[model samples]
Target: MTTQTPPVLALDVGGTKLAAGILTADDMLQQRAEVPTLAQEGSAEAILGRLIGLARDVIAAAPERPRAVGVASAGQIDPRQGDVVFATDNLPGWTGLALGRRLAEALDLPVFVENDVNAFALAEAQLGAGRGYHHQVLLAVGTGVGGGIVVDGKLYSGSMGRGGEIGHVCIVPGGRPCTCGQIGCLESYAGMRVMLPASGYPSLRALADDYLAGKSIPAVDEAAHWLGHGLAQAAHVLGPEVLLVGGSIGLLGERFLADVRLSYAVAAIKSYRNIPIVPTQLGADSGLLGAGVYARQRSGD
Candidate 1:
């Protein structure tokens, strides 16, 4: 008789989209799917129902039943306790929700919940760009900027489970207001909400199209300057061995990268220099795969 190995179910709930996949013990995705998140629905139960339905669909498509589930959602997460302390504007009515217990009960298995960005970082650290490294930082610069830290090949959750809120770290104190109600956060400028217009295009994808058409936006370059400055500050604090740049905005052409690197260099203190900023290897599927891995690790399944 042959013993069958169980796959891990990975689910990622973002403000804009929902993605799920089945992951093998070797970190390979055996199946994947995605859907839009209609957050306007306005109720934790309703939204959770939608997410659960989508996850079930993905699970059904898997070649074999998964033994454990991992979920990645946008906003703050308390991984230690498995509670979603706050999901912010993306997921309304998510604060103080016992997400872990609810999902575990619903699925009849262990469920691990994590911040989407942090999960992205964890995936990259273990199976993607940061592989073989002991210390790394995963920075996803998209509609917002968030980071994940990996020390000694494990996630550094920090005190109070607020370790990776790099986007909230003040960069231009009292400059631009952020979604977190803070002023001059990195997300205010580097995030897609700001960079899209700054790139002189309607959106990040549009900017890519325009760049291909040889009509680059000067404002995009300016945004890159600010992004670089924020990254420099991050570099100063974490001193990570490698920085993986993920998210839709990172797809911006090398021109933007040049200015961002320049700004980072200029803003960085002398003590921290020469940190390599590279692109993500997992691409758009980072969050889903990360969720699977996180669940597998947390559940010991």
Candidate 2:
């Protein structure tokens, strides 16, 4: 008789979307489902219930029901305790939610939780852009800006679990206020939510299309400047072998990459100009795949 690897169920909670899937031990995701997260319309309990409902839907859709669950959430997470230690207003009522305990109890399965960006970096270290490099950085520019670092093959969560949070790095002094209670953060300038509106465009898709068509997009250029400056700072400090950009905004296609690289070339120190700044190979599935990786690793404990 042959024993097969069990499947892991993964969930990702964002301000705008909730996604779930069953991941095989081999890192393939199946039976994926996604839905909008209407944070303002519900209490913490109601939102949690909705998340669980989505999980159940994916579970039912999966070919093999999974017994272990992993969650990657957008907020400050206490991975050791499997709790959401704190969440800013970006995710209403997500703070202090004991996600691991709550889900473990509700579904009668082993659960693990991680900061979403950290999870993304973990997956990158395992099989994505950071595959061979021991020092890597991941920057995600989207609805919210997020970042993660891999040092010596491990996720670097500094004190307060905010290590490698490049989004909050102040790029402009006395600049716009950041959600993290700071001013002039990289996110303030480079985040899609901010850049899109500042672009005066209907949407990022439109802005990206125009940019790809070789049209002059002043707002996009400005945002690229901010992004490059931030990456320059990270390169100066971390000396990462590669800097990978991901998330909705980062994947705006090759033009975005080229623009950021051009800016980075000028802003970065001459010695560091050779570093490759590329888009994440894992794309949208990184968080889900990473969640599954964490779930399988922790379930046996």
Give a tens-digit lDDT track for model 2, residues 1-301: 6766789999998777889999886678898999888887756777788889999888888888797999989888988767888886667878888888999888888888989999998888777888888898889888668899888877788875768889989999999998779999999999877888888889878877877888887878888888999999999999999998888875468887888999999999999999999888787888887788778767762
TM-scores, all candidates, are 0.89, 0.88
Superposed Cα deviation of residue 132, candidate 1 (Å): 2.1
Once fitted onto the true fold, the runs of candidate 2 whose alpha carbons sit more than 4 angstroms away are 1-4, 57-67, 299-301
- Model 1, span 1-301: residue lDDT tens: 6675688899888777788889987668876777778778777787788778877887778788898899888878888767887777678788888888888888787788888888889899888888887888877887788889888776787764689778777878778898888899888877888767655566667778776576757766666777778777777777788877778866675666766778878888876668877778887788888888788778765
Lowest-scoring 10 consecutive residues by lDDT in candidate 2? 292-301
Root-mean-square deviation of Cα positions for candidate 2 versus the true structure, in angstroms: 2.5
How big is the positional error of residue 130 in model 2, measured in Å on the Cα after superposition? 2.8
TM-score of decoy 1: 0.89
Error of 2 at 112 (Å): 1.3
lDDT of each: 0.80, 0.85
**Candidate 1: lDDT over CA atoms?**
0.80
